[model samples]
Target: MSRIPRLTPARAALAGDAAAAQAAAAPAHDADIPVDPQAGAFFDCDNTIMQGAAIFYLGRGLYKRKFFSSRELARFAWQQAWFRVNGAEHAGHMADAKASALSIVQGHRVTDLEEICEEVFDEYMADKIWPGTRALVQMHLEAGQRTWLVTAAPQEAAKVIAGRLGMTGALGTVAEAVNGVYTGRLVGDTLHGPAKAEAVRALAAKEGLDLSRCAAYSDSSNDIPMLSLVGHPYVINPDADLRRHAREQGWRIRDFRTGRKAARVGIPAAAGLGAAAGGTAAAVAMYRKRH
Candidate 1:
């Protein structure tokens, strides 16, 4: 049997205070880490923990609902392509894409959307979970670490995917809901970049965890703020610029995608497939427009 290390109340208080200060300066909050006997490992979803974006698969659900037009889907595809080619511009493109997607889903009930997410996860997300990424998360779990998925995807999306993966918690963007129906507005700053860092801090404060001893993994330089919040930052399958930045920052890098030599190539290829699917839908809208 293995002996588990427990923090003394005095030591825990000191650690909690230190972590709180570090988190207060962050831009987003995650989960309240209670006195669990587990360490913490933060993970970025999208390309870091999966072969592609969950949103792309979830979009098929929306398409079936007539919530997305083929042309809109193509635009989403093009935006992803631009993000892959121009890594530095990813944040802007992501925000725009999310805004566009949300607009289509504005009038939906929260429960209805949840059910859709559930179906998408069962049918699509399960098959897409990358083996290497799952292995990394399993490593943390095996070591008694509470693995969390941190993403810029909406909370509803994150909740379903995280639950399916059996992760400890999920930190993602929040959409406003009024009386169980979506209000078509955001409740706070979308959980991205600095916002993600802030959310982590708030979560750490509530849970009494030490961020300095924690771990965070992601695939983009845009996640630097959140990654920097922790002591161990691993850049998995990073873009060219992010890879270079990680090297300079002394961060570890892992390529989760099989047979992919570089992040630039892998991301675009995966994104291209998603784009093509989206483009096919977009073509129908184009035809309708011309007619």
Candidate 2:
């Protein structure tokens, strides 16, 4: 495991508040690209649309429902606290988080889990949505383009969010189920990093949309692949690494925390690309939609 760097009190609080502030803000960045009705707009669920991570809330609900033991909750909480204050302790920490989340839902009825999601969502998740992102999603839908929530969150919860938001649907990490009961085993790799990109490509193929005409919005570096898969990529409330990446790659970047209304492209693109590729700093996760 890699050592997490110490954070000053101010920095830690700012990191935590960034997502919520973003969610409550008005839509500042407008993606004024050529709209193609046949194409899709893919939005990353966590951080991108939601104020923070949904997994944290899911784990909390599971704990309250006694799905996991007290000790397990303590350990999970400690890990989460560590991750929040410090970022991933190890490179595999994200993988571990993914696995543990799947395990948390193992053996639960899919329908039951969906109901729980609804409860969790209603109790709190509903308010966590970033209104700015929702506006963009609505824009895509109103334009007759398919809008989907692409997320690392479980498909059940992701579907719930998409349905609630009136999106076309969702593409999310699948957990295997038998007889409508979860098997606690994933169907494939956790949809992060390169896997996200692959999922978008498959979806694009299925939808018969031109890749260049599609748009993707994300905040995490893990979703870089997904963002790059589309021609119109927007980085929203971006982590430092992703913001740097976007700047370098000439992708449109939006920082809702700032007063910037439009994405700077031409000059910033060339300038950002001229800089060196920075290290993959452990990013503060924006928990949201639990979607």
Candidates in order have lDDT scores of: 0.63, 0.64
- lDDT per residue for candidate 1 within 225-264, as digits (tens), equals 9888887788877878789888999887777544443222
Per-residue lDDT of model 2, residues 1-291, tens digit only: 112122121122223353542332222112232334457788887777876666666777778888988877786676656654432223366566677888888888999999998787766577777645655564454334577888887887888787666677888889999999998899997777788899889988888878787888888888887887777888887887887898999877755444333222111111111111111111112121221
Best by TM-score: 1
Q: What TM-score, to 2 decimals, does candidate 2 have?
A: 0.73
Q: lDDT of model 2 at residue 41? A: 81
**TM-score of each candidate structure, all chains considered together:** 0.73, 0.73
Which 10 consecutive residues of model 2 have the lowest summed lDDT? 274-283
